[model samples]
Target: MTPTSLNTGVNEKKRSEWLQEVSAHLVESYEVTESGKNPIKRVFFEEQEAPLSILSHVWDEYDTYAEATLHWLYELAEGQNFEVRLKVAETVGQLATYEFLPVLRKILSPWAKSGKPSVQRLAALALAVVAYNEQEHIAQQALNLVDHWSNLKTSSSLQWTAIAAYGGYIGLLVPEKALDNLKIIAQSGNGKLFSDIAKAVEKLFNAGVQIPKLHGLVLNTLREWVDQGENTSVYRLSLLIFRGLMRKSWIVKNDIRQPTLLWLAKESKDFEDPIVYLMRNGLNLGSRRDSILAEILNWLEFVDRHPTLYKTLARIIFTLAASSGNERKRMCYYLKIWSINSQTAIQILNLINKHL
Candidate 1:
C-alpha cells in the first residue's frame, strides 16, 4: 500500500487546476482560513516540487483554500511511504515562516503524541528545515520542539535522524532555554545523547550567526558539558566554543578552568569518558593537539601532586607525546617536565619522543 496519495488519484488536468487554484491566492491564502474555510487537509501533497508555481497559482484565488490546506500538508505524515512523508514534511517545512509557524506547530503536534517513530522524526526533520529557512519561522516553534524531543527516545534510525535534527535545532533556533537543555544533556555525558548534542553544537557554532548572546550560550553550554562529564571527543566541541569565545574575549581562563580540568581527568588513567577510542594508538600528536597542552599541564599537575595517580598520569602524558599531532607543544612540554625529573620521566619520554 502506498503511504500517501501524491496524485490525489486525479487526472493531470485536475491536479494542474488544483495547483492553479492555490497559486492565485498568494498572501490572501491566510485570509481564506480566517474567513472560516477551515480546510482540515491543508496540504496539496501531489503537487510538490515547482511549489512556488502552485503557490503562485492559488495566490490570486481565495486565500482561504491555501490557508486551510495546512492540515492536509501534515496528513502527508499519515501516508506510510517514507518518500511521500518526507516530501510532505519538506514542503510544510518550506511553509514554516512567521505567518505559518503556528500552523506548522499545530501540524507537528500529532507526531509529538503519536507512537509512530518515523512520523515523529519527520516532524522533527520538517522543523529543522523550517529553522534553516531564514524567511520562514523565526525558530520559536522549532526551539519549543527541541526541548520536547530531547527527553524523548526512539529506534537507532530515529537516533540517527535526531543527531542532525537536534543540531539543526541549535543551529537555527539559537534559543537560550533549548541551548541550556542541550548543555545539560551534554554535561550529563548521557553517553547516548552527548555525541549527538556535542556534534550538533559544533555544527551550530560553525553555521555562523553573529549573535553574541548565542555565542555566550554556546560557550557556557560547553563549560556545563565539561563540568558534568565530558569525554575527550566532546572536548573537540569544547575547544570549538573555547576558540570562538577566545576571539570574543567574553570567556576567560576562569571559564576554561573547570571544563579543562574535567577534560584532563578524562585523559587521566582511571576515569576516562567511554568514547576515548583515540588512545588505541596511531601516528603522532603534534600541532593537532596544541589545545591539549593546557589539558596535559593540568593532568601533570594533578598527578604530580597526588603521587598516587603518578602512574596513570605517566601513561596519559606518554600517550599524548606519541599521538599524531604531539610534536612541538604537547611532547615538548612533557619533555621539559621529564627533563626536570629524569629518573621516572626518561623512559616514558623516550617512547613518546619516538612519535614526535
Candidate 2:
C-alpha cells in the first residue's frame, strides 16, 4: 500500500475515534439523575452544564472538523438521551452556515416531524437558526420548511413551533416579511397561540435583531389588533404581547423609547391588567432603571385619571414594596418627589403605608 494512503487511513481512524469519544462524553455528561421529578418537567428545566461545556470546547478545538463534528452531533441527536439530543439540536442551529445547509437539514428534518412536541419545538428553533444564514437559498429553504410546518392542518403544537421559529428568525433576512406574517398570525384570533408568538417576539428583541422601525411596526400592528373591538380575546392577547415587548423596551433605542412609552400609556389607560402584570414582573431595565422608572411614572398619571384602575395599581405597588426593602424605598422616593396632586395618587400613596 502507498505510504500516503496508509497515513490517510490512520488519520480517518483517529478522527472517528475522537468523534466517538467526544460524543460519548457529551451524552454521559448530560445524563440526568432520576430524582423523582416529572420526566417532562425534568426534560425542559434541567441544566446540562457538562455537555454544554464539552460542546463549547469541541467547537473551540475542532472547528475545522465541521463535517465529522456535525455528523457526530447528528448521531447524538438521534439517540435516546433527550437532554443530549436537545443540546445537540441547539448546537446544530448555532453552527449553521451555507456549507452546512444539507447536513443541517438532514439533522433537523426528522426531529421537526417527530411525534414528540419537545423534539418538534427544538427542531423548529434549530431551523430558525439555519434561516439566519446569509445565503438566500439556504435561508429560504429553512424558512420554507418552517412555513410548511406552520400550515393550518398541522398539529397545533407543531404549528405553534413553526410560527415561533418564523417569528424569531425571519427578521434576520426580511424584517418586513416577519412583521407582515406576525400581524396576520396575531389577527387570526388564536388566543392560545399568542403566548408562543409573544415568546418569539421576546426572543427577537433579546437577540438584538435590529430592523428599522421595528418598534413602530410592532406597535402599529398591535394597535390594529386592539382596535378590533369585537375581539376581546385579541385585545387581551395583544396587551400580553405588548407586555412582553415592554419588558425589553430598555434595549430599544433612546429616540424611540419616549414615543413608544407614550403610545403604550395612552393605549393602556382603559386597561389595568397589563400595568399589573408589568409591575408584578418589573421591567428589564438593565442600567437604564431611572429613565424607565420615569416613563412608568408618567404611566401612573394615566392610572390617576382612571379611578377604577387605581386600587389594583396601588395594590400591585404595595405588594411590590412589601416584598423588598429596596423596592419600598424606590417606590417611596419616586412617589414622594413626583407631583401627587391627583386624588388617586394620594390614595395609592396611602396604600403604601398600609402594606409596610
Candidate 3:
C-alpha cells in the first residue's frame, strides 16, 4: 500500500542443506551443536565463551564459504527475515576473525538502517563483533555509521545501533578523523549514547592511539575530577583518567601506576568500579595466556596487601561476578583480584571524603 509498508512477495523457503554439511564440520571444530534448536544462541549464550583460537578456526571456515553463503546470509541479514538476520549477525560475529569488513560494511549497513529494531540491533551488534581484532579501518566504518546515527535523521533504533557501535569500537584506539566528532557526541549525547561517548574518551588514551591533547587531557581530566558532575559523569571521568593511566603504563615509567592507583584508591574509595576498571584493562592487554595469569597473581598480592580497599573492591568483584559466561567470568575474576580490582586500591580509605 505505502512505500514503507511495501513487502517483497518472495515465498518462505527452507534453508539449504548445505548448512548441514558446514554445520556438521563447524560443530566438530567448535565443539558446538549444529542444531538451531538453538545453534549459535546455544553456543554464545547458553554455553561458556570459547577460546579465541577456536573462534579463529570457526572464522577461517566461515570466511572460506562466506562468499558462497553470502546470499543465504543476505536472507539472514535482511530478507525481512528476523531470526535469520539475528543468527547471521551472531554467528558471524563470534567468528569475526577475518577481513569480512568490506562485506559487512557494504552489505549490512542498509540492513541495519531498514530492519526492525531487533533485526537492527543484531546487525549493529554483528558490526561490533569484529572490533577486538584490531580492525581499524573496519572499525572506522562502523564509527562512521554510528556518527550517522547520531545525526538523529534516522530511526531511534538506528541511533541505538550507533550507540552500540560507539561502545563496541571503544576497544579501538580513537582514530583522528572520528576523534573530535566522537567527543562532540559523547559530551552531549543522551541515554546509552552518553555512555558510549564516555567510553570513547576512555579508550582514546588506552588504545595507545594518539589523540590531539592526550597528555594534557589525561592529567587535566584527572585533576578536574576533583571538581565534579553527575555521579556517572564523575565515575566515567575518573575511569577515563585511570584507564588512561593504565594505557600509558609503559610510558609512565616512574611508579606512576602506583600513585595514580593510590589516588584512585583514595578518590574512589569504597567504589568497586575503579577496581573492575583496572581488571578489564588488564584483560584487554592479555594476548598471552601466561601474561594474564601472571598479572592476576600480581594483583592478588596487591589485593591481599590492601585490606582497606575491600568495599569498593567488593563492588568490582560483584559486578563481574555475574559474567555472561565462564571464560569471561574467569578472566573478569582473575583481573578483578590480580590487576583490575587489585591493581588499584583495596584499602578503601576515604580519599573522596578527605579531599572533597
Candidate 4:
C-alpha cells in the first residue's frame, strides 16, 4: 500500500475509536430526564459538567470530530425537552461552520414551522449562523433561507423571528443590503414587525457587532420615515427605535442624536402619545444622561413652546433624579446651573421639586 493510504487508514481507525469513546462517555455522564432540565444547565444547577462541554472539547481539540459533534448535537436537538432543544440550537449556532449548515437546516426547518416563538427564534438564530461562513455559496444559502423565512406571509411570528435573525447577521455581511431589507420591512406598516426590527437593531448593538455605516444607515432610514409623515405606525416605531439607540451613548453619535432630538421635538407637537412613550421608556440612559440632557436643553427654545412635551421631559428628568442619591445630586447641580441661564430649566426644577 502507498504510505499516504496507509497513514489515512490508521488515522481513520483512530478517529473512529476516539469518537466511540466520547460517545460512550457522553451517554454515561449526562442523563436526559423527564424533568426537562437543559443539559447545559446541569453545569450551573448541579455543579457538574455535561456532555455539551465534552463535545465542545472534542470539537476544539480534534478538527475531524466537528462533523461528529454536529450530528450528535442535531440528535440532541430533537429531544422532548424545550430547554435542551434551545441549548442545542445555541451550541450549533456557535459552531458557525459551513459543514454544520445542512444539519442545522434540517433541524431548524421544522422548528421554524413549530408555531412556538421561543423555538422559532432559536431556529432563526441557528440558521442565521451560516451567514458567518466564509464560503460564498454557503453564505448565500443562509441569506436565502432568512429571506424566505421573513417573507412567509401566513405567519407573522415566523416573520418576526426571521427579521430579528436578519438584523443580527445580515449587517455583518452586507450593510447596505441589510439596511434596504429593513426599510422594505418597515414599509409593511406592521407595528409588531416594526417592533421586531427595533429589537433586531438593539440586539445587534447589544452584542457589540461593528458594521461600518450600519448605524448611520438605520438612523437615516428612521429619520426619513419620520420626515415622510406617511404612516403614523412608522412614525411611532421610529421614535421607539430612536429611544433604544439613545439609551446606548456609545452608539448615538452627535449627528444621529441631534436629528433624533429634533424629530422628538417636532413630533411632540401633535403626537403626545409616542412622545410621552419615548420619555417614560427612554430614561435609562445610564452615564449618557448628562449629554442627552444637554442636547434637550439646547432645544429648550423649541421644546419650551410645547407644553405636553415640556412637562414629559421634566417628569423624565425627575424620574432620573429619583433613581438614586448620586443622580439626585447630579440633577440638582445641573438643574441649578441651567436654571440660572434658562427659564425652561428653572421650570423643570420647580416641576421636579413639586413631585419630590
Candidate 5:
C-alpha cells in the first residue's frame, strides 16, 4: 500500500517516537560498561556504528551539542577497536569545538607519538583540524609535533602525515620554527610531504584564512615543481595552492605574472580542465558579485599574451554568458572586453555564438 499522507496520518508522531527510541538505545549502548569491555560489541558492527552516526547527525543539527559529542567520541577512542578509534578521530575533526581544545590535545598527544603509521596518520589529521583555529594555544604543541615528526629517522608515512597535520597553521600565528620546518619540507622534494604541504595550504585558504607571507614560499615552490617536469599530481596540487593564495587577494599578481603567464602559455593547453573551471571558482575576496569579475579582468592582460589561452578564455566566457545571474552577467561583460581584444578569442566567441 502507498504511504499515508502526512497531514492525514499520525506518521510524523510515529517517526518522532521511533527516533526517541533509537536515541535512547544509542546512549545506553555507548555507555561505559561495568566489566570494562568496550561498549561496542564486535559481533554487532552495525549496532556499534549507530552511536557515532547519530552523534554526527546531532552535531550537524546544532552547535549546542558539540561538547557532548566531543566528550563521547573521546571516550570511544579509548577502546581497543581500530575502526572505532579511527572513525572517532575522523569525526572529532568535524564536530570539534574550540572549548574542547584541551581534550583534543590530550587525545592527540600520545597518538602523535604512536608506533603505528595508521594510527599516527589519523591522529595527525585530527590534530591539524582541531588546532586549525587555535594555533596560539597549541603553538608550542604544533611546533613540537612538527619538529618531532620532521626529525623522525625512520618512516616517511609518519613524517609526511605529521607535516600535513601541521598544515592547519597556514594563516595562523605559527612560530618561526614551524615555518622553518615547512620550508625544509618544501625544499626537500619528497613527493608525499610536498603534496601534503600543498594540501594543507589549500585547506587553510579554503577556510578563508590569508597569509601574505606564504606568497614567495609558494611561488618558489611552484617554480621548483614546474622545473621538475610536469608531474600532473604535483601540477594540479600546485595550481590548487596557487588558486587558494590568489583567492586571498594578497598574492601580488605582478610578482609571479611573468613566470605564471609563461607557465600557462607552455602548459595551459595541457591543464586537464578548460579555463571555464578556473573562471568558475574565482576568489570571493569582496562582498560584491562584481569584485571577482574585476579580479578576473585584471588577469586579461596576461591572457592576451598567449593566443593559445584566448580560445579557452572565449569558451569560458560563452559558457558563463548564457547564465542569467549577477555574477554571470558581470563575468560575461568583462569577458567581452577581453574577447574583443584578441582575434583568436573573438573567433572562438563567434563560432560558439553561431551554434547558439
Candidate 6:
C-alpha cells in the first residue's frame, strides 16, 4: 500500500478506537435505561454524530453530574481529539460560572506555558469563551499570559497561541499594555504568527468589546507591521479593522485623527521601496484600493505638516489610479480635493501627473 493510504488507514483506526473509548465512558458515567434509550448513547451514536445543540440537550437532561462532566470535558480539551474537544470546550463554556472561575483558570494556566500548539490554542480558546461570556476579571490574567508567551522568544507558535486566545477571548479588553506587546509581535518577522495575529484582530472586531483608543493602537500596529514587512495578510487584516473603526466613527476625536495621519506619513519614510513594489505588483489592491484612497484622503486633510509623506502618498494614489473602474475616479476626486488646498496635496498631484 502507498504511504499516504497507510497513514490514512492508521488514522481511521485510531479515530475508531478513540470514539469507542469515549462512548463507553459516557455510557458508563450514566445509568443505562432498561430499553437502552440513554441520553449518552443517543447523542453520541454509532457514527451518527449530533450537532452541538443536541449534545447540549443531552447535557441538560443529565446535568445531575455536571461537575464530573465539566472535568471530563476539560480532560478531553487537553488532547488532539478535535471533534470531542471542540464540543467539550463548548459544553464547558456553557457549564462555566463564576464559581468555576478558579477551576477553569487552573485548567487553562498550565497549558499556556507548554504543550502542542493545538492544545494550547484550544485551552486559550476555552479561556476566550469565558472572557466572551462576561468574565472581564480574567482579562488581567489572560493579558499576563500573552506577555509570558511573548517573552519566551523560542516559540513563535506559542506566542501566536496566546495572541489567538486573546483575540478569541479577551482582545476586546485589548488592554493598552497588551497592544504594546501585539505591536512588537507584529514586527517580530514571524510571518505565520503575524497572519494569525491579523486573524485575531479580525476576531476582536467580532467580539464587539470596545477598547479605549483602540483605533490609534490599530493604526500604529498596522504601520509597524507594514514597516517590518511582516506579511501582506497582516496589513490587509489591519486595514479591515481600520475601516471598520472608521465606519463606526469610533475614533472620532480630531486629536486622534491628526496624530494617526502624521504617524502614517512619518512611517512612510521607512518603506518607500516596498510600498512602490506593492503599488506595482499587489494583486489584492484592486479590491482594497477604494478604502485605501479614502484613508489617504482623510490623512491628506490633516497631514499638511508632514511633507515627507507627500511623495509616498502621491505614489500610492497614482498606482491605484492605474486600476480600472470607479476606483480610478474616486482617486481622482481625492487628488483634486487635496491639490486645491494643500502643498502636500499639490505635491501629490504633481507627482501623479508626472508619473501616470
Candidate 1 vs candidate 3: which has greater TM-score?
1
Candidate that would win on lDDT: 4
Candidate 6 regions exceeding 4 Å error are: 1-71, 78-87, 90-106, 109-118, 132-139, 155-157, 175-178, 186-192, 202-217, 224-356
How many Å off is the CA of 59 in candidate 1? 7.1
Provide the global lDDT of candidate 1 against the true structure.
0.50
lDDT of 5 by residue, 1-356 (tens): 34557556754566446656665422223434566754542323236556556666776677787666555555555544566566666566544443345544555555555555455666665655555645555444544555776666465655665665655542244534444465555555566566567666555433331553443344445544434443444544445555544344332233343323223323444331323333343322232235446544544554566454554455555565554466454544554676766554456446555654
Regions of candidate 4 where Cα sits further than 4 Å from its true position: 1-87, 90-105, 205-209, 248-356
lDDT of each: 0.50, 0.57, 0.47, 0.58, 0.50, 0.54
Q: Compared with the true structure, what per-residue lDDT tens digits does model 3 show for residues 1-356? A: 76544543233232434334234222211211334233232222223343344555654666675565544555555333454455577656644335555456544655566646565566666766655446676555555555666566335556555544544443243344334444444444344455455555455544432443443344444444424443444434444445444433332323433323333434544323434544453344333234535643544454466545444444444444444455345644444444444434232222221322
Q: For residues 13-94, could you state the per-residue lDDT of candidate 2 as single tens digits? A: 5643655654532221333344532233122223445455665576667768756876776655443466556566667776
Q: Write the per-residue lDDT of candidate 1 for residues 182-291, one digit (tens) a residue.
A: 55444443456555565566555544334534443454455544444334544544554443322222212333332232333344433332112232111123332444
Count of clashing residue pairs in every prediction: 44, 0, 13, 0, 0, 1
Sequence-dependent TM-score of model 3: 0.36
After superposition, which runs of candidate 3 have C-alpha atoms over 4 Å from their true positions? 1-71, 74-107, 114-143, 169-171, 175-182, 186-189, 195-356
Evaluation by lDDT, superior candidate among 3 and 6: 6
The runs of at least 3 residues in candidate 1 whose Cα sits more than 4 Å from the true structure, single-residue gaps closed, are: 1-49, 56-68, 78-83, 135-141, 144-164, 169-179, 185-224, 229-349, 352-356
TM-score of model 4 relative to the true fold?
0.51
Per-prediction TM-score? 0.41, 0.49, 0.36, 0.51, 0.36, 0.42
How well does candidate 1 score on lDDT at residue 209?
38
lDDT of 6 by residue, 96-141 (tens): 4333454455455545555566667776666555556555564444
Between candidates 2 and 3, the one scoring higher on TM-score is 2
- Model 3 gets an lDDT of 0.47
How many angstroms is residue 308 displaced in model 5 relative to the true structure, after the best TM-score fit?
19
RMSD of each predicted structure: 14.9, 13.3, 16.7, 12.8, 17.3, 15.5
Candidate 4 lDDT by residue in tens digits, 213-270: 4544555566655665534556555666766655442323433333343343233443
Residue 304 CA displacement from its true place in model 5, Å: 14
